[model samples]
Target chain A: MAEISFPLPDLGEGLIEATVLDWLVSPGDQVERNQPLVELETSKSALELPSPQAGKVIRIHGAPGETINVGEPLVVFEVPDNTAGIVGTVPKDDAPKRRVRLSAVLDED
Target chain B: MSESTTALLEAGARDEQSVKLSMQQALNRALDEILSTDPKTVVFGEDCGQLGGVFRITDGLQAKHGESRVFDTPLAESGILGMSVGLAMAGFHPIPEVQFDGFAYPAINQIVCQIARMNYRSRGTLPMPITLRVPSFGGIRAPEHHGESLEALFAHVPGLKVVSPSDPHDAYHLLKYAASRPDPVIFMEPKSRYWQKGDVDTSDAGPLTGARIVRPGRHLTLVAWGAMVARCLQVAELAAEDGIDVEVLDLRWLKPIDAEALATSVGKTRRAVVVHEAPLTSGLGAEVAQLITQSCFDTLKAPVERVTGFDVPYPSGDLEDEYIPNIDRILLGIQRVLEYRRG
Candidate 1:
């Protein structure tokens, strides 16, 4: 199993920090991807942040009413080693498909 | 190159006590070092305080430097830069962040009028010792304006120095060096390359300004900046197999460009291709091409070729691959320069 630390994502554009409103799930609870993880109150509005992956919660950071900065640790989860538990760009896993001699890629004209 | 620049290049070559660091980590470390060393230094932007920046380039900075020195500001880009001007005037080396390259648009009034001209306007009595950090360029499929390339816009200004780092070592040292400069420096961080990991020497004071030859080839030269530097290096490697020896030059500084380096490189190879993510016309590539033409005109083999984005608004994620100059486009550019026939 691998443990993943999920940071508090940018709740809104131009928002740097958010107040912890409530935790829907406690540590040790198994959660599914996109499940309601916690409620955060930013300057823009209050909303529930969803889980980025399916895993068992290992740790939860900040108490209700406590504030957490964007990118700060929000939750820790335990999952299979092969599973990725965060959001962002997808990894390039396959061998580049366009491998050819430089001559082949260039045009004669 | 001067003695210090050569020393930095050599130190990078030596790779002493190097540690693998992503551009994000490297920039963070550089900011940490700057904040700790300079008592007057301050870092702030929207979400940069406790949030550590939208991309987390300033991650954990507020905790380490404390809220007073490293804190967040309102979403107002103008306010952020206007405060930087005030902070610099008050003897503080204000290191303000614009959050993203696109966000800088709103701050142009402050950036161009105040930060870029305070030195000249004040007759150098009060120089804006500020480093405006903007996570620049595109590849992560961001929305419109989020991935804009404004090097030409910033470079056009008189009193500002512009730079972008292609790797971790340069990112680490260049950020620290920019903060140390007496003049305001627009430090453009390639957004897509932030997650890239490479060996960075924390002590390496990378070139304050000037281009460095990352790869040397005898047949032709591929000149690029920011994310395009890495792409050029890759093209050079692939070209090597096709019997085309391509030299890769990273133009670290956009303003006060190292004309000497351009002359030296194109002078030897006599063939050059400049690539950038910005649009074709009025891009920084045009200036570089002019510089090469002016300096190495007599010895040129063919006109300097430019493989750049279309002359349109920089597209968002879905059209990024189409907009950004790809390996195929660059290879064709190389072929054009390498197989040029004098008419």
Candidate 2:
């Protein structure tokens, strides 16, 4: 088993911290990738944080109403060995990688 | 072939493929050029990344630079501008868009108090190298709060360089110039002209300050900037039918008002008229008139006349045409200035 930790993302546009409103999952609860794990309130808006990796929840960092700064570990999860190198449940092979090149001039007559 | 002939031949060939771009496309090219050349340059604002901005000015920038370099921020104007200042202080060039002119009011506190004053207050020790992009002026028939000509508000603040491009050529070059400057700059785009097409010579980019005489004349000087510039030019052409020679000057930079160029034009023409979409009370047009009065006091043959919007909240699209100065209103200013006599 591998232990994966997720930090609160920098809910952009200068928001540095958010208060933990509620935890959707408890310790030992199985969570899927991109699943809402916690509800957080920032300066003026409420946001739901999704799980970055599919795993069994091992620990919840803060209680309800506790403010958490960005980059702080919000949750820790234990995952099977097959998901060790994988981020979330999406396999690297299945995700199509695309690149777009923009030319100096897009259109010309 | 002679050397001069060879140069002429090259110029002729280059003129054939010279791209005909609108103000929106010019801005895209400028942002793409900056992003491709400089890794430190980051662009962000509401819908600027994936959506290519509300005006589509940043179209395809994210596709070219990737989400890390070019991305969208939240709808909060204050947050976007405040973070841009921080990013600049941390040695990054931030191009933060304010979406529209009216939206800029929410960010005015951070813009005027923090970003504008940082360089001067730090005694030049710290530099806020930020370029704020704001789409301003009326005529697009946008809803309320989307078309306020609030250049005067930003121009009132010292240490801030405010620039408005009258055409696509200036939009492309001036945007790059504003981003490259060490001081903070407010790059106001005339949104109404975003679709207006013109020939953009990519090779020649001029200084940030100084006025450009779009049309030269000897009878009267007509001063305007951004969207109003086109109206002035049209009015000048119409005035010629009556044998009134009118010169039009595009005051590119607002904060550092191009007083010398304005004075020179006013001195020669002897009569001056200033036009803008903002309210006449302390509007940018008033500042230009004051400058003309101060510099060309002895040379002036008549008091400078101003044609501007009334001092009231910007109305909805239905009434915007009446609020914004048109050719008829501009002609009134010209006629009033021409009719004035020394006491």
**Candidate number achieving the greatest lDDT relative to the actual structure:** 1
In the range A1-109, model 1's lDDT, one tens digit per residue, is: 5456689986668899999999999999999989999998998899999998789999999999999998889998886533311213422322222344454232223
Model 1: residues with Cα > 4 Å off, grouped in runs: A1-33, A38-58, A61-109, B1-16
Q: Could you tell me how far off, in angstroms, the CA of residue B51 lies in candidate 1 after the best superposition?
A: 1.2
Q: Residue B183, candidate 1: how far off, in angstroms?
A: 0.4
CA lDDT of each prediction against the hidden true structure = 0.86, 0.83
lDDT of 2 at A10: 81
> How many residue-pair clashes does candidate 1 contain?
1
Residue pairs that clash (backbone atoms under 3 angstroms), model 2: none
Q: List TM-score per model, in order.
A: 0.83, 0.75
DockQ of 1: 0.18
Question: Residue pairs in steric clash, candidate 1?
Answer: B141-B317
* Fnat of candidate 2: 0.00
